[model samples]
Target: MAQVLEFKLPDLGEGLTEAEIVRWLVQVGDVVTVDQPVVEVETAKAMVEVPCPYGGVVTARYGEEGSELPVGAPLLTVAVGEPSAEPEGSGNVLVGYGTQAPAARRRRVRSAPAGTAAGTGPADRTAAPRNGHAVQPAAAPATAHARVTAPAAARPQATAPAPAEGPVPVISPLVRKLARDNGLDLRQLAGSGPDGLILRADVEGALLTGTAPARTAEETVVRTPVAPAAGDGTRIPLKGVRGAVADKLSRSRREIPDATCWVDADATELMRARAAMNAAGGPKISVLAMLARICTAALARFPELNSYVDTEAREVVRLDHVHLGFAAQTERGLVVPVVRDAHARDTESLTAEFARLTESARGGTLTPGELTGGTFTLNNYGVFGVDGSTPIINHPEAAMLGVGRIVPRPWVHEGELAVRQVVQLSLTFDHRVCDGGTAGGFLRYVADCVEQPAVLLRTM
Candidate 1:
């Protein structure tokens, strides 16, 4: 006897309501252990691998890659306990959502003959479980078909064809696959399950009646969407990381009355200081770390910019401690990973933290917590070879510092025209939090430190 356990998507935490399926690690008929990573998903905050709670043979997967599923939606099913081969020990189990124990079980039937790929086959008439109900698999055909689909666990009720227009009334993924493989439009069938839900019997009935797509039709027409030809223009859905970024920036633009102030400063001293420190035979300090240190010092003098405006409370909340967020653009999208207690850390620590976070961001392994809770943000757009940008405030945060590329430029040094490494710095702050005077002082101090690295030593 085998009990088919239905596994639904779990709450990924941090108020995430849904996730887009990125890839499936296992397929139908694959044996898995408890807590094995079954699927990889991309949520608004980060990429996560979801683990299965039950160890058994994978029977079916609900959603396809690139499909979005809400939390608690059916992800897959596994035949636990009764499946022949079992692993020696359970691997690392993730404490995800809870699942119901098997209520009952029955042996699978193998009487029916296996069918073809383009036609109906032996359906795993397992009464699919839902909403914490124990699965009660029905007696299934023993024959292994070229393509077999899982049947929804439903009570004994007269099944009928569902409407063709609007959403399809199918519950069993196995039935969906069967109709899909045979090219039977489910819209043409009336469902018999509760609430007109299409069941496996409905699909099998259609196949037996020759309503399935003919051999020539199956060969010519497929259910999958074809790629757009060149010049056809492609439409990528705004979802996942890209969608999250779009929403956050749009909200920042809509709610924050932001203003930008920028200035070009001689960064020759800062560059020389970095070279000196690295030449001292220690971990090389990056320019971003140097600027981060400068920002922290500047924030101490003008803490007003290191705060966010609470609209509901109608107050400007100034944070005493700084959780610094630095922007890093990766293959997925732009992500700001926060370094906790950044204000308390030195230049060397900031450099190490920035490197770690940047690596995590590039690999798409940042957690939701690491991606949020920042008092201020540092945008080093200079890495992209851009000199300047009036950066949008990362919503809920009061200000952001933008750094441009440092390039050699002729400038007046001590009343003498000379070539100096120069860089542009911009500050975008919420007008509600601070006025131009405070913002100006902060930027001026930062520029002063860049012109003379010794000024940062006093802040130390």
Candidate 2:
């Protein structure tokens, strides 16, 4: 007899409450090793490969790809212990949780009798070799509430119960919600997905074919709409990263009394300094990294801006260490990846970390910790060729410094009109954190450093 264990999505940390399933790495009946990635999920912060802690034959998967499941919800069930010959797991944890040794190669468990539920009965069915090929078992009648494992050969001919008679083979909650909203009985329709799994498409297809009648206006449930009117245009659901950004920005606006200050600065010296550094070369420093270094220096000078207003405590808390956040735009959306203790890192280290974080942001591999805990933010909108933007302060943080495109512009240099590389800097600060004097002093210090890069030596 094998003991069946259920694995739920672990808390991925940083206050995240839920995640959307991106892909399934294992199938029912596949043997999985401990700490092996069983599924990939996308939280608002990043894409994460969730590993199963228990090693066993996968008995059932609970959700479909693209489905959102709350934390602590069942992800899958694994059948462990028994007359099974698979190696026992080392009981190691995922990255950041603890150290884990290399997992042993996965071996398939011998299939049990056709009608036996997983984790039950003796090994009476035909046993297959330890080769990678899957063992196909005889097809059994599908159950309404549980997913049954069968051999690949039986999938094509498997008969699913009628929707009107048994539980519908549906995995996604969104599909169930869609059916409910349209007053459709899921049990009546035959699913087209594997093992007769009812998908969103199946429900949608039934609607198009007029198989399910639309609810009347009076019967329709009224709720806050996520998207706009149907005739307006295509409505993208405000979910995932985009939704998180929207909610944060909205809350920042609602709660914070913020003020913006802007200035034009000569960045010719900063550019020249960067060129000289690169020419002297070990590792090429990025302009964003230089700007970040300057921001850290400025924060050190005006520590008030490096603080957040604790509304519940009715006090402004100033932080000592700078966890510098830099905004990077990716296909997913705008994400701010933070560099820890940035005030303590040199320009070279900052450049390397920025490059690493930016790459991770682009690849959607940043962890929740990497994306949060910033005391200050550096927004280099200059990369986008924009002149200026009054950026919204990342909530709970005191201020964000926005840098715009640096281009040759007319400016007075040494009392003579000359073409100099000029850039626009804007500081958005929470009014409650500090007065305009503090914000202005910080921006002015940043501008001075940009105009004269050597001035950074005093802080260094």
Across residues 1-460, which tens digit of lDDT does each residue of candidate 1 receive?
A: 7655666677777677768889999987899987788999999888888878778888768766866666766688787775333212233333233233321222253444544223222122344345434233344433333222322332233444455457796765766886776567887776654456675656766666666544454344553334222223444555678878998999999999999999999999999999999999889898899899999999999999999998999999999999999998988888899999998998899999999999999988788889889999999999999999999999999999999999999999999999999999999999999899989899999999999989877867
Each candidate's lDDT (Cα)?
0.76, 0.76
After superposition, the stretches of candidate 1 with alpha carbons farther than 4 Å from their true spots are 82-136, 139-232
Q: Please list all clashing residue pairs in model 2, or write none if there are none.
A: 163-187, 163-188, 164-187
RMSD of 2: 7.4
Deviation (Å) of 15 in candidate 2 = 2.5
TM per candidate comes to 0.73, 0.74
lDDT at position 419, candidate 2? 99
